[model samples]
Target: MPRWPYLLCFLLICGLAQAQSLYLHSPQGPLRGGVNEALGVGYFLGIPYAQAERWKAPLPASGWTAVREARYFGNACPQRGVFTTRLGGYLPPQSEDCLNLNVWMPLAAPPAGGWSVMVWIHGGSFTGGGSGEPVYDGSRLAAGGAVVVSLNYRLGPLGWLTLPALQAEDPQGSVGNYGLLDQLEALRWVQRNIRAFGGNPQNVTVFGQSAGGMSVCDLLASPKSGGLIHKAIVMSGGCTFVRKLEEDFTFGAEWAQAMGCPGADLACLRQVPLSQMYPPEGSVLANVVQRVEAGGFERSPWKPHLDGAVLDKVPLQALKEGRAAGIPLLAGGTQQELWGELLSAPGDWTSFEVRAEKVLAGKGKAARALYQRLYPERPREAWAYFQTERTLLCPSLEAARVQGEWALSYGYLVSYRSSVFPDLGSFHGIELPLLFGTQNTWPAQAIFLSAQAYEDSLPISRELQRRWLEFARVGEPGWLPYDSGKLLEMGSELKITDNPYQERCGLFR
Candidate 1:
């Protein structure tokens, strides 16, 4: 056979495949999407899901008559700071008109009903991050016989600011929770339109990390999210952590006053420049943290809050009362949530004991005895483990236990240390790249993992994807539920162990 003939045939097949995956008819309109030939996935990026004005509820995206090109990502919601710039490199153009989402679906024939849908929400403390981040690319996950969707909701002050003036304007007097409302609207968009993209609207799973995880819990609790979400995966986010809208009113007033709009004058506040929204010397997060400390509340104020109309009760309370019954829930965090800064320096058993004594002040002696008993010999690691349990692991487990009472709930703990950054052992967010199979796209992988380490982690990555896909498909992640008193532990080895940290967590309770 002539080599030229073979080459010509290959080109013809490639052209036909490209044409076949290029266009699709959506309920909203005709869309032109791009395809990853190598991955055999069709991607529709930057599709507008809704439209909203600052401090207002999102409205359905206007239908488009012409074919819209969804080849590039949409604008990220307005955000600033090192978290947005240095860490994720999400330097896309910013805008308030950013209620858009991206979708990736397998090009192959759909399963019996339709492909299971997984919606991703990125996390940056509710102030930064967007669906456009490179690490969030859904091609690999979508390639695993699923439809993957990621969205951009409002962030920072623009997304959450609440004031009396704003409340009075709302018919229900709703305040704060605007960002959460954006998420709800996105889910509604999915239900109305996902089937057009070869997804099962009834089998949707919402998953997120950090602040995004927190949003998942919020959605699970909201009556507005009823029937829109079937399964939820909350990573490193506790269920019970939310404040009342009234609590944020004071902060909002102060912020407005600081911006020269005393009394939260809506007219004047609306006129403030975007640059002034997040001043360079101090950030909205810093200001909120200061107020949070002054108000004596332990939870971060930047996240979603209970606006009476949007959320009737605290998420955990709602779960305990069976408001979210029958919804399968998967929730957990890393083994060491805040390892880098806490364990950055060298320390010995004596040093750890001294630090523990100071921190435990009133109960120093008893605390020391308990610590010694729980984590003997490895004194320095004890502090990191305790902090992790208190901040991420225990809270997550507590939520799972409560959820298990009315639903099939699972808990997980990721203890897989990176070979390159061994000292940062299973630090916060280590599971993301592994689950998405986006190790090559993750910024941390470039900085930390060598090519060989990336290769070695492939099996683990694939396993995570399989487990998560199975959960989305059949509401089981190939393990027993949390009520069984066992939780899956993912690390160098994978196993289901009797719940760890019961005694340690009890101390906090």
Candidate 2:
């Protein structure tokens, strides 16, 4: 159980095991992955679980006789618009059949108890990002006494083209929501087969950031996802938008019509190339889903629909109605995410003033007027507070409030900052490395070579693991349960803070 030396040896062997045998029993055939000394673990990367019919809904993978070569990553599902993707500037091949998951397991399964498993869902407004990103390297977290799983979900048009035309088709007949389905299938695979890799299926904690955080909230709201996962942690944010059934049926129909699909019908939609499906630039909804879109596939919009099963009702309602799976919850956002999301923007009011005005208009003229009066000059703090409400702070508190009615829920704010990205505020998604203790294997391997970086974050990583693993093992994450009245602020120093945030947060009220 000694920590530092235990992982020290593994970090030394990262490149040596790149070709390790990784064949395992997936519903598909056997798959392969590489191993790394830096992680001191065995890994299986990019294993597919399901397939889709061009623009049609996703289908379960076809069973096979021999194992599949899961070594190199399968193609990333097609996405659209240039944004924060996994590979970013790198353009690898793309495809329609991109439902893959990655696994990192301890070389040793820790005697008989095995290891706690944490499945990570990458965030890109549910449109971009992949399992292959170096930022998500699981070696660090796995080395911290757990198995780690990260997966790629369909984003944008390829993943969520819900339209009435597609719904009229056969087989319980629906269109869109491919991303959520892909997650359900991946979790199912983990439940059935993770033990072979030394992970405890029943002790699984589903964790994610941003859109991934939205997915976590939805999964908690899902009956199908219940029992499959025992604990949940959400970072960055949670779900706010839920699609009406009629709205779901028509969004894609409109897009398909715009695409020149025959009468906005399913047949024509089923024929359009997945790549060309994103809404054109300057479109109204496109702006809403912009931050979520990535690559060239287009339309990585993140909203849960009434899928009839799996996700029967929208998450906000389900949680309030006490319909979601009652599991332990750990949730929160950063201290300041306004300037964080738009990190490149200046720290002054002029940079964010216009944007603030436009955003407040969405809240209605009176509210806009009220907001402008209070925040007219747009001090740098106003914009930053705006992001905290929409992204991390408000959603985290709301999710805990809703879920706490039925389950044990602990809330927090990751007030820590990366010494690396100094100007980016505490920022969105910065905690990714902190959560996994992978600061060394970050944006570049050069970071790990720096002794100061390792020294600063290793203890932080251990502290996070202590809280995270404890939650995975039991239910509470070693903090006071969150409620409207009182919540815990977890940091280098811990304290009970109320509302966790307000003013800008109170705007939502």
TM per candidate comes to: 0.89, 0.80
lDDT (CA) for every model shown?
Answer: 0.80, 0.65
Highest TM-score: give the candidate number: 1
How accurate locally is residue 402 in candidate 2, as Cα lDDT from 0 to 100?
74
Tens-digit lDDT track of model 2 for 394-452: 86667876788888887777666545555656666666766776565535333335577
Q: How accurate locally is residue 35 in candidate 2, as Cα lDDT from 0 to 100?
A: 63
Task: Give per-residue lDDT, candidate 2, residue 245.
Answer: 62
Model 2, poorest ten-residue lDDT window? Answer: 292-301
Candidate 2 accuracy as TM-score: 0.80
lDDT of 2 at 413: 76
Q: Judge candidate 1 at residue 6 and give its lDDT.
A: 28
Clash statistics: count for each candidate: 0, 18
Across 366-444, the per-residue lDDT of candidate 1 in tens digits comes to 5557766877876666677766776667877777888899889999889898888787788878888888777876475
